[model samples]
Target: MKFDAILDPDSSPHEVCELGLLAESYGLNAVWTSNYPSSRDPFINLCPLALASSRIRLGPLVVTPYEMHPYKIAKALASLNELCGGRANILTGGPTGVNATMGMDFSRMVGRTRECVEILKRANPDEALNYEGNIYQVRGYKPTWATDEPPFIYIGANKKQMTHMATGIADGLMLGDTTERRLGSSLRLIEDNLATHGRSRDDLAVSCLIAWHVKEDKKLSSSEAKRHLALRGMLDIWFLETFLDAEECKIVDANRANIFTAYKQKTDVIEGVPDAIVDKLVENLSMSGDYDDIDGHIETLKRYRDMGLDEVAFKLHEDQAAAISVIGERILPAFQSH
Candidate 1:
C-alpha cells in the first residue's frame, strides 16, 4: 500500500512548495492540500507544488460539487493535471465546511456525487459532449485542449449508499477520519459493491485520512490531536458512545458550542471534556505520542492494510517537515516492499 500526506490550506505557497519537495524526496506517493472553506484556495495554493515537484502527485483533498460546479471542477482538475504532466488527483464529495455555513442544502448528495464523478470520467475521454445527468448536465461542452492524463477521481465517502456508489463509480474511494473498527465493515460493503459492478477488491482502491501527531514532547502531540478532534465528526450519539463514557459523552454533547469555538479558533483548550477524555479520543482517533509510539502506529496501519486499504493519507500540522521525516523513516518503510 502507498502512504500519502494531507496539508491544511493555511500554509503559504512557498511553504507548500518546500513541503512538496520534502514529500517527493521522502518518496511519498501523493501530497494533498485540503479544501477548507475559510482557508486559501487549495488549487491555487498547490500550483507551486505541482510546478516544483516532478514525481509526487498533487491535488485538493476533497472538493464539493455543491460549492463548485462539476464543469468548473473538471476544468480546474484538468489544468492542474496538465501542470503535473498528468500527476494530479481530486477527491469529490458531498457538502462540507462552508457549504454548511452557507446553509446549502445537499440532501441529494448521493446523486450529486455520482453525477460529479460521471462528469469527471466523461471529461477524461476525447469524445465528451451532450450528456445530461440528473444532478449535473453537459451540453456539447468539451475542453479539446485538456490533457489525456485525466486526474484519478476519488470520492470521499463514509456511509453505505454513498460508499457503494462512489466505489463503483470513481477510480477510488477516500474515507475521512475513520477508525479501524469502523473500517472493517465499511471495506466489506465497498468490496461487495465492487463485485456487483463486475470489479474486485483489487480494482477499487481504498484509503482513509488519519490525523498524525508524533512529537518529541508527548503533551505537545496530544494537544495538537485535541485541537483537531472536532474534525473527526464525533458529535453523533453513536460515535461519542464508542470511546467516551455516558457522562463524558453527555458532557461533550452539552459543550458542542465550546468544542466548536475551540475548533474554529484552532485552540487546544477542550472545555467540558476532561483532558484525559481528550487524550483518549486523540489516541483512538489519531496517531500521536513520541518515538516509542512508532510500533503501535505501524500496528494500527497494518490493520488497515489487512482490511484492504491501498493508502492512509496522514493529515499533518505544525512542524510538518519533522512529522514527514518521522513518517518517511518509520511508517513508509514499514509498508514498503524491500
Candidate 2:
C-alpha cells in the first residue's frame, strides 16, 4: 500500500511546505493538511508545497461543501492543481466540525456531497461546465486555465450510505479512524456498492486515516497518544467495542468529559478510566510506542496492505519530522515491492 503524510492544521504554510518537501524526498505519495475552522486556509496553505514539490501530491483533507460551494472548491482545487502540475488532491463531504461551529444545515448531506463530487469530477478546462443538481447548480463555469490533469477527487466517507455513494462516483474513498477489525466490513460494503453500480474494485481507490504517535521515547509516545486519544473515533462505542467489554465501553461513555478534558488540558491523565482499558484503546485505535515498536507497527500495516488497502495516510501529531523520517526510513521500504 502507498503511504501519505497528514499534517495538523496548526502547521504553517512554510512548515507544511518544508514537511512536504521532506516527504517528497522520502518518496511519500502525498502530503495533506487538516481542514479546520480555526486553522489556516487549507487550500492556500498547500500552495507553497504544491510549488516547491515535484513528485508528492498535496492538498487539503476533508473540506466539506457545507463550508464552501462546489464551484468555489473547483476553482481553488484547479488553481492548486495548476501549481502542482496536476498532483493536487482533495477529499470532500459533510458533517465536519465546521458544521457544528458554523451551525450549517446537516440535512441531506448525502445529496449535497454527491453534487459536490459531481461538480469536481466534471470540472474541465477545455469545456464550460453547466450543471444542474438537486442541491447545487453551476452555469457557464469554465476553468479554461486549469489544463493540467484533473485533481484527484475523494469522498470523505466511512458510513454505509456515504461509502456506497463514493463507490459509484468518487475517484477514491477516504475513511477516517477505521481499525483492522472493522476494515473487512467497510471493504465489503464498498465492494457490494461497486457491484451494484456495475463497477469493479479497480475503478476506485481506498485509503484510511490512522493516528501516528510513535516517538523516540516510549513514555512520551504513550503520553501524547493518550492526550490526543479523545479524538480517535471520539471514543465511540462502536470503535471501543472492538477492544473493550460492554461495561468498559459504558465506563468510557460515562467518562467522556474526562477523556475530552485530558485532551483539552494537553495531558495524559484520563481520570475515572482504568489504565488497562486506556492502554487497550490506545493499542487498538492508534499507532503508538517508541522506535522499537515500529517493526511491529510495520507488521500491522502489512496486514492492512494484505487486506486490499490501496493507501494509508498517517495522521502525525508532534515532531512530525521525526515521524516522517521513521515512516520514510523504516516503513516505506517494507511496502516498496508490494
Candidate 3:
C-alpha cells in the first residue's frame, strides 16, 4: 500500500509546501488538505506545494458541490493541475462538512453528490462541456489551457448508494475516518458492485483518512487526540457502534452536541461527555499516541494493507514535522513495495 499525508485546513501554505517537499523525498504518493468553509481557499493554498514538489501529488478532499458549482470545481482543479504538472487529485462529494461548518443542509445528498462526481469525472481542459444533469448544467465553456492532464477524480463516500455510484464511475473511493473492520465491510460492498458493473479493481484506488498524532511527548499526543477527537466522524452512531455498546452509543449520541462544543471552542474539556468515553473515541477512531506507539500504528496500518487498501491518508494534527520525519523513516519503508 502507498502512504500519503493529509493536512488539516488550518495549516499554512508554507507548512503545506515544506511538508509536501519532505513527503516527496520520503516517497509518499500524494498530499491533500482538508476543505472547509473557514479555511484558506483550497486551490490557492495548494499552489505553493504543487510548485515546490515534483513527485508528490496534491489536491483537496471532500469538496462539496453545494458550496460551489461543479463547473467551478473543475476549473479550480484544472488550474491547480496545470501548476502541478497534472499531479492533482480530488475527492468530490456531498456537503458533509459544509453542513456542520457552514450550516448547509444535506437533505438530498446522494443525488447531489452523484451529479457533482459525474461532472468532475467529465472535466476536461482540452474541450468544452455541454453537460446537463438534474442538479447541475454546464454549457459554452471548454477548459483550454491545461497541457498535462486532468486531475484523478475520486468520489468521497461512506453509505451504500454513493459507494455504488463511486465504484462504477469514479477513479477511486475516498472513505473518511473508518475503522479496519468497517473498512473491510465497505470494501466488500464496493467490490461486489465492481464485479456487477464489470469494473476492474486495478483501475480504482481505495484510500482512507486516518487522523494522526504521534508526538514524542505522550501527554501532548493524547491531548491533541482529545482536542481533535470530536471530529471523528462527528460521533456518528454507525461509526461509534464498531467500538461502543448500545447504552454507551446512546450516551455518546446524547452527548454529540458536547463533542461539537469541544471542537468549536477549541478546548479539550468536554463538559458533558465523560473522559473515559472521550478517550475511547480517540483510541478507536484515530492513529493516536506517542512515538513508542508508532509500532502499533504500523501494525494497524499493515492490517489496512492486508485488507487491500491502495493508500492511507494520514491526517496530521500537531508536531507535524516530527510526525513527517517518523513516517518518512519508519512507516514508508514498511509499506514500500520492492
Candidate 4:
C-alpha cells in the first residue's frame, strides 16, 4: 500500500512546498491539502508544492459541488494537474456541516455529489461539455487550455448509497475516519457495487483518512488526540459502535457538546465524559501515542493494506514536519519494499 500525507491547510504555500519536497525525498506517494472553510484555497495552496515536487501526487480534499460548480473545480484541478505533470487529484463530496454555516444547502447531497462527479469526468479540453443533471449542468463549456490528462477524481464517500454511486462513476472512493472493524464491510460493499456495475476492483482506488497524532512525548500525543476526538467521524454512532457498546455510545452521544467544547477549546479535559471513553475513541479511530507506538501503527497500516486499501492518507496534526520525518523514516520503509 502507498502512504500519503494530508497537510493542515494553515501551512503557507512555501511551507507546503518545503514539506512536499521532504515527503518526495522520503519516497512517500502523495501530499494532500485539507479543504477547510477558513483556510487558504486548497488548490492554490498546492501551487508552490506542485511546481517544486516531481513525483508526489497533490490536490485539494473534499471540494463540494454546492460551494463551487464542478466546472470551476475542474478548471482549477486541471491547471494544478498540469503544474504537477499530471499527478494531481481531486476528492469531491456533499456539503459539509461546517461549510453549511456559510449558507450552503445540504439537502440532495448524494445527487449533487453524483452529478458533480459525472460533470467532472467529462470536463475535458478535447470537447465542449454539454450535459444536464438534476443538480448541475454545463452547456458547451470547454477549457481549450486544459490539455493535460485529467486528474484523478475521487468521491469522498463512507456510506452505502454514496459508495455504490462512486463505484459506478468516480475514479476512486475516499473513506473518511473508517476503522478496522468497519473497513471490511465498506470494501465488501464496494466490491459488490463494482460487480453490479461490471467494473473490477482495480478500476477504483480506495483510500481512508486516518488521524496521526504521535509526538516525542506520550502525554502530549494522547492529549492532542483527546482534544481532537470529536473529529473522528464527528463521533458518529456508526463509528462509535465499532468499539463502544450501546450504553457507551449513548454516553458519547449525550456528551457530544462537551466533546465539541473541548475540541474547540483545544483542551484535553472533556467536562462531561469519562477519560476512559475518550481514550477508547482515540485508540480505535486514530494512530496515536509516542515514538515507541510506531511499530504498532505500522501493523495497523499493514492490515489496512491486506484488507485492500490502495492508499492511506494520514492527517497530521502538530509538528507536521517531524511527523513526516517519522513516517518517512520508519513507517514508509515497511511498505515501500512490497
Top-lDDT candidate index: 2
**TM-score for each prediction?**
0.95, 0.98, 0.95, 0.98
Query: Which segments of model 2 are wrong by more than 4 Å?
Result: none
lDDT of 1 by residue, 1-338 (tens): 79888986688888889998998998999998888877778888889988888999988977988888888888889888888889998988888886876779868999888988888888754675666888778877778888557788899888888988986788889987776767887888898888888887777778898889899899898778888788775466555576777998888788888877887798999778787777777877788998898999898888788778888899998899998899899888887772
RMSD of each: 1.6, 1.1, 1.5, 1.1
Question: What TM value does model 4 have?
Answer: 0.98
Q: Report the number of clashing residue pairs per model.
A: 0, 0, 1, 0
Query: What's the lDDT for residue 105 in model 3?
Result: 76
Instruction: Tell me the TM-score of model 3.
Output: 0.95
**Per-residue lDDT of 54-141 in model 4, one digit per residue for the tens?**
8888888878887888878877888899898889998898777546658856788889888888888888878999988886888997
Q: Positional deviation of 95 in candidate 3, in angstroms?
A: 1.1
Q: What lDDT score is found at residue 234 in candidate 4?
A: 83
> Which residue runs of candidate 4 sit more than 4 Å off their true CA positions?
none
Lowest lDDT 10-residue stretch of candidate 3:
94-103
User: What's the lDDT for residue 67 in model 3?
Assistant: 84
> Whole-model Cα lDDT per candidate?
0.83, 0.90, 0.83, 0.88
Candidate 1 lDDT score relative to the true structure: 0.83
